[model samples]
Target: MAVEHNEAVVLRAIKDLVIEPIPVPDLKDNEVLLQMGSVGICGSDIMYWQRGGNSRFRLEAPMIIGHEGSGTVVKVGSKVKTLKIGDRVAIEPGTPCRRCHQCKQGAYNLCPDITFCATPPDHGNICRYYKHAEDFCFKLPDHVTLDEGALMEPLSVAIYACRRGEVTLGSKLLICGAGPVGMLYMMAGKVAGASQVLITDIDDNRLEMAKSCGANHTINVNGRDKLEVASEIEALMGGQPEVTIECSSVDYSYDLAINATRQGGCLVAVGRPSGRTLLPLDVALRKQVDIKGIFRYVNCYPAALEMLSTGKINVKSLITHHFTFNETLRAFETAISRDAKAVKVIIHCDQ
Candidate 1:
């Protein structure tokens, strides 16, 4: 086998990442072995490298650091019937215990015992070789490349956000932040039939990216007050948005989002803010707005993959930078450094 030993990008401590080798273990009956092709450096991954913790999950010890990945199957366990050796697939990082109540209700992402990749106390897949549950792996279509497969993870988030926000035809949308998540939200909102999607961000580069990706209006709210921007956003949309997806993780952004939404609209928070933030509760109560929070996604991978395969959404533009497996540390540096103008950085796993 090509994978005689496994090499991974491990975070030993804050801002410390090194390529380390570990023994490759045999696959379980329900698992499939993969030769990683591309892995994306998500915001959480960057946070783990910078702060040793990403708001919710903190690194108590050394751990592999990535979950947005896709690869070609090198081996399959005896019990695996749906996939085979040499098959290309996108890996769903979260593996939920099928026996859990949430799993029974088809909300496996909410399962208490879910072991998500790159999260604390769980191993991730930013490595030369990875083993994952067969059921969680979705085969990529012939038209979708491995790079596109890796993007399925974030796109799934957008899909879930759109669903939670109830984005439909003629719906007016407002998205806070034009980062990767916000960019995905803009694209997903369009696919969900949103008539108008306005995105706000501090960075002009990101706002331009949002425009290229399908944002109806891009606002640079760098120095503007949140309340003032909220009013401007309403004016641009002709009125308050029917749905607002907050992806900035900033206190002011959240505040503005709540105020910019229509009286009976929906507000969805997708960003993982570092600490607790205040909300406009009085307005929410009086307006009867629907406030919802999404943690990861369930049953969105297949839909996301289909969207990519059919060309309903194009994610290739989202990838702004690329690095090799050995340049893992440099990749993290570029990801965290705003000067790089990095939207999404992909690490090509050398197999």
Candidate 2:
């Protein structure tokens, strides 16, 4: 049966979110129609809902707002060869124009013509029914739940950040922020053979969660001086971190990352700092630290899935709350509420 109507969570304007009817998407030749199973509320989604935009993208018009999601294929397009009806899949959100130079160079995430879900003009997959390009969807294994499948988006991000930072065996890692992304970075770094992982956050609750997830050291940076925090991080790790992943978008976190990293090490910026973020450029330059930035991820879905399937990376604990599709507003509330201590909120869209 052809689906004709869809109900989606739409952000009409700043601080405005509503569940409304949307037109059912028509599948393209290489696309598949999905009955969305699970959708995770991300930090970006919160930004759009609260501020109407992030640093790079703005909500110019009403748009459905979810990028981290997984679904079961209800129908497959004629040219779709790898997937079929009833296949459960994790969506990789961003699809780049294949003819672009970036795409040709295997860095499709950098393609300027890419269409990323819930970013500006791109509508997302937080609906009862959604259609996506076949290549952007990765099939979920039998053991993987839809909730875990949805989490693949953020997991891929952590994997990519670790790759950029060159996390290797016995590498001392300092990750600033114990948010979902920060916690995932710690896990990914550990899997990539980092001997010791130190993660910092202002929230005690979040830091506690990080500790339960195998973080070697967790620090509460609330009201602490940046340099002092940096020194403490190095002391806790027994040496300066070879790779520092700054996952907190605060200026203090950036300063801590730069000051704490070892000389000639890598500093990968995973957080999107608002406006102009002033950092200790002299420290970074004098230390000859390699600073890099990642936009989403490139070719990391398979690795993320493999980690999940092999039990090498367990993200099940990261999921703190669940809600039905109709209770999306409440889910978002829980995600942004400081008292909720929510790490990952999953919306069961199948209902």
* Tens digits of per-residue lDDT for model 1, 1-351: 566988999998897889999778689999999999999999888888888888768899999999999999999999999999888999999999999788999999999999999999898989999999998999997789999999999999999999999999999999998999888888889999999999998888888888888888989887788778888988898988999999889988888888889999999988767777888889887888888999999999999998999999999999988999998888888987879999899999953
Models 1 onward score TM values of: 0.98, 0.98
lDDT of 2 by residue, 107-145 (tens): 999999999999989998889999999999999989998
Collision count of model 1:
0
Instruction: Using lDDT, give the best candidate's number.
Output: 2
Which candidate achieves the best TM-score against the true structure? 2
Candidate 1 C-alpha error for residue 46, in Å:
0.6
State, as a TM-score between 0 and 1, how close model 1 is to the true structure: 0.98
After TM-score superposition, what is the CA distance of residue 317 in candidate 1 from its true location, in Å?
Answer: 0.3
Deviation in angstroms for 298 in model 2? 0.4
| Per-model C-alpha RMSD | 1.1, 0.9
